[model samples]
Target: MSNERAKILIVDDDAMNRVVLSDLLSDEYDIIEAKDGDEAIGILETTAKDITLVLLDMIMPGRDGLGVLEVMNEKGWIKGTPVVMISAETSTPQVERAFSLGVTDFIYRPFDQMVVQNRVRNTIGLYLKQMQLSELVTDKIYERTRNSDMLISILSHIVEFRNGESGQHVLHIKKITDILLRALLKRTKEYKITEEEIGTIATASSMHDIGKITIPDEILNKPGKLTKEEFDIMKQHSMNGAKMLDAIQFFKNEPLMKFAYDICRWHHERWDGRGYPDGLKGDEIPISAQVVSVADVYDALTSERCYKKAFSHEKALEMIRNNECGVFNPLLLECLGDVADTLPKELNDQRTSKLSDADFEKIARSIFESTENDTENIIYEQYLTEHKKSQFFASLQHGVTFEYTYEPSMLKLHARNAKALSFPTTMAEPENNSEFWTIFGRENWDEFAKLLHDPQLNNDSFSFNSEMLVKGKKCPCKIKVQQCWNRRDPENPELISVYGCVEFFK
Candidate 1:
């Protein structure tokens, strides 16, 4: 009797009584009835799909309503299903007991027809409201959880950067997690996953190592086998991380939260249950932990720890596969094997090397040079060259082309091949366009620089971030790249190419 329509199940011994309920409610709700409490339990166990509410008789032959209530509580689905008890057995004790077992309401028999209709309608309305509120709360919490995960990742990168450890750890974990999550779904199809779910999972995975927050920096960066006590403290990070994530309600039931929880809680659990915290046996441990267990250990093994030199990737894989640590789900171990075959030497090499102050200084240098070149040929007579006042103007004649190659992983820009790249900040946001990124281009850009260096004829340096562009298009005179110096190029500088102009540097 369950469908898109509202479904209500009634359990009462009296046949004529069932007839009365069926006639009154059947028009608006899909209804099911059982002759006794035992039969009612049977129907619920067999086909309770999509049931919204239960109008249960409190007393019946064989099994009583309370007994059925106990079963529903065990099923865990009762939290989502509403139950209202109805019977002649509405003495104080019976009423008290039904409520204790989670019945939503109690109505004694010899009921008023109008009262019954009103109570049922009101109960469903309240149920609907609670469900809606729960969803809203869940969504809010999930967003916070996702943000928390992102925050953890950023913080972790900062820590690694301080230690001269580049973002190799973060990138490695992300790629490995993606592979494992996909492989598991393909193998078992345990849950229905969508693109959005994958996104949250990835975001939340950022916190898998959040427990490391509690570990002392010395021990964390020691790069060797942790002493027994130090290792013990380190082990607690998974538990600590899980607790941190658990504090947020949205993450309490989310898929990514589940993944994070596993990472934080069970990543240390052993296949043989000898690992630590709580040694859950293989398959007994959470699947998330099992997948990451392999990944974390693998990354740690291959990374250059202060205590231990980085192991060769080949050696690392061989050790994990050859050993019986039982750290990974056997299926995941095989998947890792497939990925290992293609893992690059470059990935290993990038374990160190992050942008430093020196790097930023070089960018500043370029800015200075670009500025100096513009004043070289500026006819102070034609225009008042407020040398510093004309900051946005590009010295195209001496403007040196900046060619930048971005490391797809770190997200920092390097510049070359473009003269006078400048980025100016705007206090006022764009009024009509969300396409502000258009300074780079609205269409196909193979690399980020193409778009950033791309010009927008509509806007000027004062209008937006002109930090990455030349002053303007080629001048009407078509001056040669070497012809001018110490002068701010006119509205149009000489064009070597559509995006090219002469430049100078300090």
Candidate 2:
């Protein structure tokens, strides 16, 4: 099974050709000889798993090399096995067919022994290396996922410890989130959600109420409804949790951490714009948070708390349906409806009565140990390698990306590798810089505003270039603008956000 001594199947009608190839490869690989395509197909059907490379002949008496390749392709046997075509034929169509049929390399007749040996060895080496690299990448992805899960579990347990609960609240939220997310992936095309992203969102759901750790025990475990001042103090947890993550250097730029921060800070936001520390309405809230919000609310309604008894599944669904909790994303509500019937059974299976003090302490210690170990540096390095290779980062390294609020406020001056555009780095509010407009000029701003303000203008998206005042000189800059809004509000389609980026002409 080792690639160094992998099996090679040499298909050639000519006895001398087969002998030469076998003689060349026999020392390095176990060789199999097939006189024609039929014999090759038979051997492959019988022992394809053992073969690593194929030296196929183009010219043969019956059912030639191309025919055998067609069979291999049909059987899905051509993927891992490298096929080399041995041919004297010069016809363009014949050669193209061999290549098209997934030939790895073409070795022409009157071949030098060294050339053939080198080609076979090199092809095998290249493919083996590729396979190894793919496996390494898969392992790295698994490691990242495991670390993320462990971190979230630790944080969730901490939240439970503070509230004096069994910690099953976070687990319940994760379960419901997974079901809802899976339903969303199956039912919607409006948002592009990948399987990996689903796992990240579900794991991050455990930290949706992580901010609750900041709230005083008296407020967190009130046993009665919180007073106005206590409630207000409790609401600050979202922002506090976000700021806490922001303080960690390694977590600042991680995508998973970013999702956790968003979920923590914005899960309270309502689709109707009534709920929040930020009053961010509808789609302004990230989907990561929206999904968790529904899950958290559902779990809260259905689970026993210090202040309230667990409600029946039907009653909980009724309350959510009537918007008794708060306005939720309509699409998410649809996802909830799709999975509602099965939730009770899922919850019953996952329910935990209580967590012993020792177990809670053990989990907390493991979390602290993990933090002390600084595993984030490993994840950060992996993320950096991948991020550096991305085209988006490459573009930012050469220029700046800017987003504007519907209120016409500058979101941020985003640039990677360096400050591609000059902005206030020390001022209390860099966005207040009047010179911000100077980079794009009035004409460019007018076009951008027109796109953002007018729903009909160029289908609400446009790209153009204009001369801008950069560093006290006129410079041409490319600008792209797109209109974004809260999709939950279809009645009023006003743009709530504008994403635009500028690049200096090279």
> Residue 157 of model 1: what lDDT?
49
* TM-score, prediction 1: 0.39
Whole-model lDDT values for every prediction: 0.57, 0.73
lDDT of 1: 0.57
Clashing residue pairs in candidate 2 are: none
Worst 10 residues of 1 by lDDT: 405-414
Q: Model 1 off-target regions past 4 Å? A: 1-3, 154-506
lDDT of 2 by residue, 1-506 (tens): 63457899999999999999888889888999999999999999988988989999988888999999999999999986889999888899988888899998889889888889999999999998998999999998886565555556556656765564545888888888888989999998667878888887887788887777667655676666889999999999999877756655533467778888889889999999998889989889888888988998888888777667889888988899899999999989888999888888887788533333354344334333344444444323322222222223223444555545535343544422114445531122224556666654667767655656665652254777777776678888787665555433567655554555666797
Off by over 4 Å in 2: 1-6, 27-30, 41-50, 61-63, 74-76, 161-167, 178-199, 216-218, 247-254, 329-339, 345-506
The CA-based lDDT of model 2 is what? 0.73
TM-score against native, each model: 0.39, 0.62
Taking the candidates one at a time, how many backbone clashes does each contain? 41, 0
* Top of the candidates by lDDT: 2
